[model samples]
Target: MRKATFIIPAIVIVMAIIMSSVFIVDERQRALVLRFGDIRSEIEEPGLNFRIPIIEQIVLYDSRIQSLDTAPIEVTPSDDRRLVVDAFARYRIIDTRQFRLAVGNGGLREADRLLEDILNPQIRAVLGADGVTSNTILSSDRAELMQRITAQARVLAEPLGLDVLDVRLKQTALPLQNLEATFARMRAEREREATDERARGEEAAQRVRAQADRTVVELVSDSAREAEIIRGEADAERNRIFAEAFGQDPDFFEFYRSMTAYERALTGENSSMVLSPDSAFFDFFAQPGGRAPAAVPAPVE
Candidate 1:
């Protein structure tokens, strides 16, 4: 019974030691052995790993790509235009040993802080470079600018054991204080364009109206001239007819003219005229044939 108790206790102690010494490194992670606060070995492959108990410690870091979002930062382009820029980056710990050494016990969180420090300045530098304008950052050329920033960040991040795979601008916009001013300027420009268009339309309409008025005046003048020509022709025809009638018979024509004059002068009940009985105008009424009476020869002197 005494030997049985000692054997069981030894087996239990051995199991405890084995469990503490052995670790399984997953495919998605990298493992590093630390001895006395210093890196001893880095395990890059996935498999069973062993370390001395109590004297060595294992630290695992995710080997997959990670993302880091930076805070919104203000940048001024070469044109002196101020913009608020938000950016993000994709990175991975390429060298686990170097990463562990650089970050110590802070792990991924500390690495993020170091990467932000590397990335923000490059964003500012590339975006604010001599030829890079705010217009360029807001355009498709922004892709090229991002590439430049990524290249610069990768170089600076090498010592941090980080490989900056890509950097992208999430949002690029004018600052809050500049928005209203920009909008006002845009509105003024549109209003000016609208006013110009309206002026052009009014000018065209005036031209059309002037053309129509001229046409109307020409048409009315032509009509009036035509009417005057027709009236003159008709009056000449009437006078020709009267001349032909007078040539046909002088006595009848004279009698007809005298009757017409009498009818006109005697028309209406209110018409009145005072005249001597010997007046030639009353000769038609005094004689049956409308002929004037022959006066007797004056007495011989």
Candidate 2:
């Protein structure tokens, strides 16, 4: 009975001791063993671990890709405009020894501190010195800019034994008031340009219309003058033809003219006048050139 009691107690104590010294190393986890508040060893693989129960301390970290989000920072551009900028990065520990010496605070709080002290100033310098805009956080040269920033970050992280793989800009925006003012200015400029273009078009249209109207009036006047000249020439030609035809028939033309004159002067409505034998009218009846004969013509025998 005495031996049985001692054995049971010993087993219980052994179980408790084993439980205290035992730890789990998951596939995705890496651990740093610290003794006397300093890195004593590193476990880069996943398996079971044994330690001095109260003397050694272990710190675990995810060996997979990890991310860090930085706080929003205000950056001034070459144009003297201020923009609020925020960003993040992805990184992993490539060397376990370096990681143990390099890692400090593993959360966003530490990232914020690093951003405030080192990253923000570098970002401003690069962004300001760029041949581009002062607000050039992310741009066509974003990759190059980020590369420069990563180099600087790597230097800062060297003491902590961390490597900065990449940095990315999440968002960039101006102050609300500045944004509103920018929009207003853009709208006004566009509207003014459109108005000027429209005025120019109208002026061009007016010029075209004036030219057309002037041409129309000139064409009409020219046409009317040409038609009048043609008509006058035609009348003149008819008169010339009539004069030529008249020269070919002198006796008939005279007789016709005298008959026309008689028709005009002696109308049926007016009474006829009797003239003396020696009258001027009788002369033309007797002989040509208005001469009357000395004696009347005798009747035919």
Candidate 3:
């Protein structure tokens, strides 16, 4: 009974020691074995791993790609325009030993801080460089600027065992204080453009109206000239007809002319005229055949 108790206790102690010394490294993880605060081994492959019990410690780190979102940072471009930039980075822990050495016990949290430090300066340097205006940052050219930032950040972060795979600008915007002023300037510019367009339209309309007015005047003058020509021609035709008729029959022509003259002279409802009955105006009236009366032999003087 005494031997059995000792054997069971020995087996239990051995099992406990084996459990503490053995660990499983997941496929997505990298493991480090440390002894007396010094790294003794790095386990990259996933599977069973062993460490000295009670004297060695194991630290596991995720080996997958990770993302870090930086705080909004303000930068001034070459043009002195201030902008707020929000950025993010995709990274992976490439060297677990180097990462642990750099960040100590703080692990991923400290690494993230170091990464931000590296990223912010590169962002500022590339975005605020000469000729890199706020307009450039807000345009498609911003992609190139992000690439520059990523290249620079990769260089700086390599020492921290971080591989900065990609960096991107999440949002780029004018400062809150400048937004209203910018909007006002844009509104003013649009208003000026609108006014110019309206003025051009009015000028075009004036030119069209002037052309139409000139056309109307020319048409009226042409019509008046044609009417005058027609009237003159008609008068000449009438005079020729009258002359021909008179040549054909003087007595009849005289009678017709006398009738027309009387019709014109006696016009209104209350028309009155005073003339001697013996006047030549009554020649047609005195002779039924429209012949003038033979002059009576003048009294012997």
Candidate 4:
């Protein structure tokens, strides 16, 4: 009888423990309580929660930040250049009820896939309104584009209860098919500009050098002309002074110059001369009177 009583109490205690088991919900979770494998249609906040064991289940949801990485998208520019654009998004569950009804727990992945299709076209549409090509847009306009991508994605996702916080472009570049052609064009343009700039610099340097050379020629020619004039003037001044000195005794100067000429012309080792005793040279050699010159006056007795 005592054994039967112990067995009955043990059974009751085990059933109570099973029925009273509770789940702890942290600060970042929102959950749905499922009754008999069906959602109870009410969402619960974070706290200690109880449910019937073996008959009910807790479906937890992430209420904090979450991320979705999208596949690379292909976009064309105003100039028809193609590029590959990779994007990502930051989102959080804002309205649990709508999220559950619209996406369900299993539907988030499918929703993300849907988001990719929706956001890319929006990106293309906005980008098509721009003046730049895909390559330029990819290079310099990434920040503006990222904001646009997020804004467009938010518009598409906000109605579905997933609040898209931000969208970002992870990578952007020309499509592999167009990579070589685009890069070659860019390189050629840069090289052509460099060539033009170098040509301009060389031309300027040549002009400056030419100007310096012309100035040097002009200066040298002017100096030579001035020196010639000064030399000519000095010669004329010397001739005038000599003429004035010779006027002091004209006949003596004439005789003295003639004697110097005779000495120079006749005394040289390679010289020969012929002269008459009565030649004009005799006029100077004769005595002061009209008489013929006497023999050298016998030792000046």
Top lDDT hit: 3
CA lDDT of each prediction against the hidden true structure:
0.89, 0.71, 0.90, 0.74
Residue 200, candidate 1: Cα error in Å is 3.2
Q: Can you give the lDDT of residue 32 in candidate 2?
A: 78
Query: Which 10 residues in a row give candidate 2 its minimum summed lDDT?
Result: 292-301
Worst 10 residues of 3 by lDDT: 292-301
Scored by Cα lDDT, where does model 1 land? Answer: 0.89
Query: How does candidate 4 fare on TM-score?
Result: 0.74
In angstroms, the error of model 3 at 120 is 0.9
Alpha-carbon RMSD, candidate 2: 9.2
- Model 1, range 1-301, lDDT digits (tens) per residue? 9999999999999999999999999999999898987888999999998999999999899999999999999999999989999999999999998887788889899999999988888888989999999899999999999999999999998888889999999999899999999999999999999999999999999999999999999999999999999999998997898799989986777777776777767889898899776667767666776565532222222
What stretches of model 2 exceed 4 Å from their correct place? Answer: 95-112, 134-139, 237-301
Q: Is candidate 1 or candidate 2 better by TM-score?
A: 1
Measured with C-alpha atoms, the lDDT of residue 26 in candidate 3 is 100
Q: Locate the minimum summed-lDDT window of 10 residues in model 4.
A: 292-301
* Candidate 4 segments exceeding 4 Å error: 1-21, 105-108, 130-142, 249-301
lDDT, candidate 2, 1-301, per-residue tens: 9999999999999998899889988999888787866888999889999988778888887777667777787777677777777778766655666655544535334544554466677777766664647435556666787788778877776654456777777888887778989899999999999999999999999999999999999999999999999999998997797578679975555555554555565778865878776653344456755334332232222
- What TM-score quantifies how close candidate 2 is to the native fold? 0.71
Candidate 4, residues 10-57, lDDT tens digits: the string is 999887876566877778888777787567744555788787777787
Report the number of the highest-TM-score candidate: 3
